[model samples]
Target: MNPSSDDTMHTLLIRPKAGRLLFSLLCSLLFTLPAHAQEADTARVKELQGVEVVGRHVTGKLRHDSLGGMSLDLSFLDDMPRIAGNADPIRYTQLLPSVQTSSELDAGLYVQGCDNAHNGVSINGVQLYDIQHILGIFSVFNPSHYSRLQFAGSAFTASAANRLGGFIDMQRPDTLAGRVKGELSVGLISSQGTLRLPLGGKSELILSGRGAYINLLYGRWLKVEESAIRYSFCDANVTWLYRPDARNTLWLDFYGGNDRMDYQEDGENYDARLGWGNRMVSMNWEWKRRGLTLRQTAYMTRYGNRFSIERPDFRLRMPSGITDYGYRLSLRRGRWTAGTDWTLHSIRPQQPETEGERQTTTLSATRRHSTEGSLWADCRFAVARNMELLGGLRANVYTIRRSAFFSADPVLSLLWTSGYGQFRLTANVKHQYLFRTGLSAVNLPTDFWLPADERLRPQYAYGLSAEYRTDLIPGRLQLSAGLYYKRLCHQTEYIGTPFELIYGDYDYRKNLISGKGENYGLDLMIEKRTGRLTGWMSYSLGRALRRYPGRFSGTFPAGHERIHEFNAVATWKAGRRWSFGATLVWAGGTPFTPPSYFYLQNGNLLSQFGDYNSGRLSTYIRLDVSATCRIKVHGGRESGLNFSVYNANCRHNDLFWRLKFNNGQYYYAPLRPLPKKLPFLPSINYYIKF
Candidate 1:
């Protein structure tokens, strides 16, 4: 049971004689995983001729999990192994195992219990609270017309409602049949293109765009010392569909994103140009009379981030914004599914000059309003014919206005399946009123940004999960294991109140406090998706701890608590037209604080963090490689020539947290230095379709 398939080993170093790139890598290595249904309704009409639905992956209507816990499927990408923009589906879920990718195309992913606003993102289904387009490292949907991807951890199901450890769902793509497919790309780290058309008939039209420049490719290493940084970003999407017939349907979605950063510093060593962004719009509808089946959706979102930091002497300006909207309805009855959703939020953080400010300076800003609601039910029955049963339930209501707070969260689940795999038990009581702000002292953004409290009182969690799936060999061994325990009542962070004083870059004075936190985890998977050498090996063991009591390192162990994670990937098929792939990652040392000691206040220098993740750094592994070559510039087969090589071990590995005032000795800054090793980077690409 070791199929480990991916990029299905296509080898054709340089073809000429025919054999068509070795039959397109054996039809993309005939995908492996997710087939059992009596090997798909009786081995496909006894072998083709009048049956269709095997565009790879052993046949598909789409639904996969070759032992890759927390499922995601877009027909499972024809047979996997396709990475070249559109955040490669969040970089293939960062090769799983508690996910990790703080930057380098960041969506701030550091999942192993959670943090980064505590996981929650959705697309076609709505709900997308700050999916980030930049300034937090990439992600804001643009996977060139995706079509379903889901991830849920921390006891979720009951239709996954309001906050707690994990959730990501994306859906879009199914343009009334086909025709008009597109893909255009350029790279240094950013560039994308997608288009699909087919309107009339049942209705359809799709468009996508993406952009990034980091000052046009690093802009000479951000100018160091002189302290110059430049950034740029963008995202756009449009979708429309109205199927007047065929049961009934209506859908419309528009998305937007923006990010800008310009900086200069030398003498006063500080200047600024900053901007933040997010915008969303959505609508969904569907109906199937009689037997009953319905779906209705709604969405609206807005987010703004503004900043100003200068220094002739010193100056700061901060502006923040937030807006949210929601609605939901779902009914299926039969397999069962009933739903509901309501979300409302408003947040504005404003900074009103901190008087004479200096002693190492620290400023303050905050404004907020909140409301959250949820109702859920989802089910799938059938206890025999191979086994099946999936349950659900959800209820959440949270609010905070000025200082009067409120919260109520409830969630539950049950899963059990036969077909050689599947077992589940989940429970949740999640909640999170609001949080995110503060990290200057080198965390950059030149100090100024706060918002948490319209009375932020909603931090609840009582989770438990037990999941298992197995198949160590029938069509190839695939395995998944999950165990989680969550117990958290309240958690928020940021402290220093004395009137919100934040003197000098290091003067960190006065009050800036917020409290509560906890997380627990364990998830593992082993995959070999079929023949010609496949890929996948993962591991994750987690814990996130935090409890603030007033300040000065009140309680710690939450900076994306990481305690061992490993990943391995491989690809082969070097015969017909040449194909190659490789990946390796290992983690175990993520918790940092090296600023030693400092004191100055008023003008800033009050950093004294000796605890909280106590310091650990020395475990990270890297190795990446890709090679593709196929010849055929006509009709189908995607018209040849594609080559890629990234970090083939350029292995500089360190992207921690930096702040080492050098000789001036502000020391305690380090993040972005994985130079323990390096080498290998080559790229070449070409693809044409007509």
Candidate 2:
């Protein structure tokens, strides 16, 4: 029996050759038939019903594409309340379900109980060590330059390795623009602009610049009551894209930024100048054809910090930095991908110089050389009708001086999909050869990078997690929950004074104590996606602990650990031109170590230390609100004005506590917050796009 009309049409849709043949036959019949016959045939042919196709895409604040990865849509930043009139990526990242930050005044992603140094950050596939400015108030990445952020917590791609915690990848699109465009923004503390020019049909270029005149705006207020202080920062970016054809593309990216602070003691006789910066340039090329893809990247990056002090008796200069040259190559076809990465690191731990009346002396003038290489491969395949598996392996080699170390890490993820929701189970092992150490409790530019050698072993982490997500309201509301446990090995804690660690000429390795750590947590989140009022609420319950077998004793709370954290973010679109946003964050305070007692020793007062990380600070609470108005101009242009208030409740959330010895007694108290003159800040920003 012949198929019905609908069945025949379905077959034709499935078989392109049959559809093409039928189309050709119809054309020939129209051309050969007589006019009356053609008219009669056309009148008899029936019109087909319209067909519609729909596809799924990710939207909203958080996305779960991979087993243990979450991607954030950059557009959300535009509608959220910003700090100091600046939309910050790092600050928003800390609001993710399982993510944690050191403190309000700090800018570091402490994911899964791992420290900031354990996380990896890359821009256009190039590694960046220092990605912060203004004492962590802002990230180096401008909101206008990028559109998305990918974070891999447990299961990451093969191309991103060498990190024990999470990996953040921010890639700029390499495509030709259809027209010229530009964006300009002016805020209370800084100003930034970006311009994109189409250099013909196949090439495009982007330029961006940002400058912060904090001293110009708050110089008098920033100064201590008895001291003189000034600060400034600036950065520039350039990106070039060439797409000769559909199969080949190339990109060149360059970024450079510098931060400087000058301080003079009011009554003392010493003046100091501190500066730090980052410079990087990278080139990437890709080729794709017929289900196969190839990519290659080469880059160079440098981060340096310098501190100088001048006094009546002598002058001192201390400098430390790290420079890297790296290359990466990757290829993919179907469900398999493989890559190789290699980098050469040149580290200057510290080279201090002191000048007297007649001569200049230099200390620790040695540069450590290290090399790291890795080969990795990954594949994804279906194991059952509703189950799939993703697995990968990485082989790493590290060499510093004459010593070498090797490790093999594995990643596995299993996924099961059902009508109700999706569930994922993931396991991963990662390692880090570079270590970041500093004396400050916060993330400061003075922190330096160190290589793993014979004395200091590489750090490694093993983690296991299970997560489930579902659409509670089918396209409007969603819910996700995850539970994870991570174990860390060969962790190191610094046990030396700042002067000794940064200037004194001692075996620095001896000051480091090796230990182990464990982190376990539960993360839950619910989000509203499609509505005029959209937002997400998240809660995290976690514990991070460390055990130093020799130095202190048993396990203790990690400095950045928070036992309970809750966050809610919402944005309301009142109309086409007006919108409002608000964010609320509340969390338990982290742990600290305080002095137990004080006594007179050798004619000097000394204090016996208490248990490590035994003291907990008070709870932290913050609320922010913002309102924005946008106006449409000619030629589809847009102009906007935004007003933001940080710490709207005027709460006194302390950054940290310091030990104070007064009246022959020892105690600990909260230190003065940043922007000492102002407990809260309200800012305005004006922006335009054409």
Candidate 3:
């Protein structure tokens, strides 16, 4: 039989090995179909033939409109090497293709070249503003508290349209356990515990807590000759699930975390204290009847921080934060899902309070209030026998003071399944009403949140992507590849330094310049899904460029852009009692603007900056490995000991640069690297499960 045009096109697009697999699958399908337009006669059949395969497992879940997304089970984190003896969800996303962070220790996610504020992060369907603890070392989401994590790439559903970049969702287990279960872990730097208790036959409660003791165990370890620092953090999470009946369910979630840091510099006559915290609470209810389901939710969250600096002659304190109250309602029936969501925001930009030898003064930005709402609908349907279409529409409204803005966003995805594998093409348009601005070079808690207004308008993005996936070796190996492009509008870059931001006029809008950006990339990965050895290797090639009419005449590279990235991760189950994991990550350096010239005039100095993001840091490379051994307990329970080395090679990678004057000329040099003395970080943890 001759193949159709669609089949021919698909074959051409796929690789040679995948083409052959598709041919085989097509042949099997054709032969298994009924010869005539009639059902087979079951009574006359003599015997049935079948094939059974063992020792094979499905590794990842397939989600609709997930052309370049990932749906990972909680067990996936267990198989990977930990960072600082902790399994962090935000850090895991950095290992995937087409995703990047500010640096090794930064937790902010920059997806498809978008800023951290553009990405939406949520737990139990409620959006969260500050999602990290201990600065950027660890995220607030404890792996033990979450059952699954989902990352949506360029293509996202209508309900998640507000984010211009991507979406990160953490979900707890929906099922109620019949018996009591718990896990406890103690590590070199921190300790955590999770416990699940059944209230009755239909209700259950899960409690999790984590805290850091680095300050207690190794005080001033991250210190230099003239400076010393101390930092600590703690967080708690509680989730309650109630399944009163087969068709009804209710959930209550609460999370709170805080971070504190103290620093002193004797040579510079500087001393500072920084503190931040996050608190959130949410309630959800769900009901199902026949083939329809309805859900409602309400949530409230707040994040705030204070930074105080003291010198011999001056004292200054800056405070900033944001608070949100939100509500959502959704209904689903068969292939259709619709939802409405609204949120009210209260924002306080960074403002400084100063006390001099003479008097005390306070400088503050205008406190602002805003509201955002969205109506969305998503549907999936079959277009042909082997093709499906998933589409969604979102209408958003934003109100700030007396002004209002509206936008319509859309998402579309096409999926094709055959004997060989699957192919998906997706596109989406998104908008973000909130923006994040940071004073530090990297992602830090000092960053402040602001809402869109007349001067700083909302951000918009348009994205398109195509992906292909197929099994290369039955149940053992798989291949995935994708191409994506995104166009961004109304991107803002703050041109002020930390001092200017803190001491200058409170009208912060004067320091921001709006611009446009474009990002395109290619992602490829190959993995072995089963057997004694299971792992994956991935590579990404991408470019991110920005243009501002007044600030710069030419296009320049974005600060977060990384042109090349490669990662290799593997896990070996040496035996039932022992397991080993290793990972390697290498990427291009970050971009920075160097000083062009400096002049001294009348006992003062002035400098001119060079091209935007023209200088590059040294290449970044790191290797991590871990080993774990399991032991049996008295009552059939299990315990494990894990030893991990974050940067085994101790390669000191440059975090940023500093300008220096040499021979009367100015030049830029690599500043102090992170973990100044020892880049090699090792830790051990003991865990038990019952």
TM-score of each: 0.29, 0.89, 0.89
| Model 3 error, position 4 (Å) | 19
lDDT of 3 by residue, 439-532 (tens): 6667777778889998899999889988887767655567888888999999988887654533455445777899999999998988776667
Best by TM-score: 3
lDDT score for residue 130 of model 1: 54
The order by descending lDDT is 2, 3, 1
Each model's lDDT: 0.60, 0.80, 0.79
Give a tens-digit lDDT track for model 1, residues 1-690. 123222222211323433454555455447433454544544532122232222224211122442223555543422233333223565666666666545342455556556656676768667665565544443667665677677654435566666666667777765474566676655565776767677767787778888876566657664444467787888888888878887788988888887788778654466777787678898888889877889888888877767776665656555666777878887886777778887777766544343233533345545556666677776666666544556566666565653544444555445555655667676657666665555542123323323335444456677777777665764444677777777776565544432343243323223344566666778787777555666668788877777777463466777656677778766666666666766777776667656557765555546555666678666766665666666653454354444555455565555566544433446554455222232334444454333
**What is the TM-score (0 to 1) of candidate 1?**
0.29
Write out the backbone clash pairs for model 3.
Answer: none
Q: Give candidate 3's error at residue 49 in angstroms.
A: 10
Which scores higher on TM-score, 1 or 2?
2
- Look at candidate 3 and tell me the lDDT of residue 547: 97
lDDT of 2 by residue, 1-690 (tens): 112110111111224555565666678678666656555545554333333333333235666674567777787877778787787887888878888855655778888788888988888778888788777877888767765888876545555669888888776754566899888989988998888899999998999999998878777776543477788889898999999999999999899999898888664567889899999999999999999999999999999999888878768777889999999999999999999999999999855687756456778568999999999999999999778898999999999888999999898889888776788898888889999886667777777789999988999988899988876766667788999999999998877664452335545576778899999999999987656888899999999899999788878988889999998888898998998999888999888887787676554456677888898878888888999889766786889998898888788777777754444555567864545556677889998988
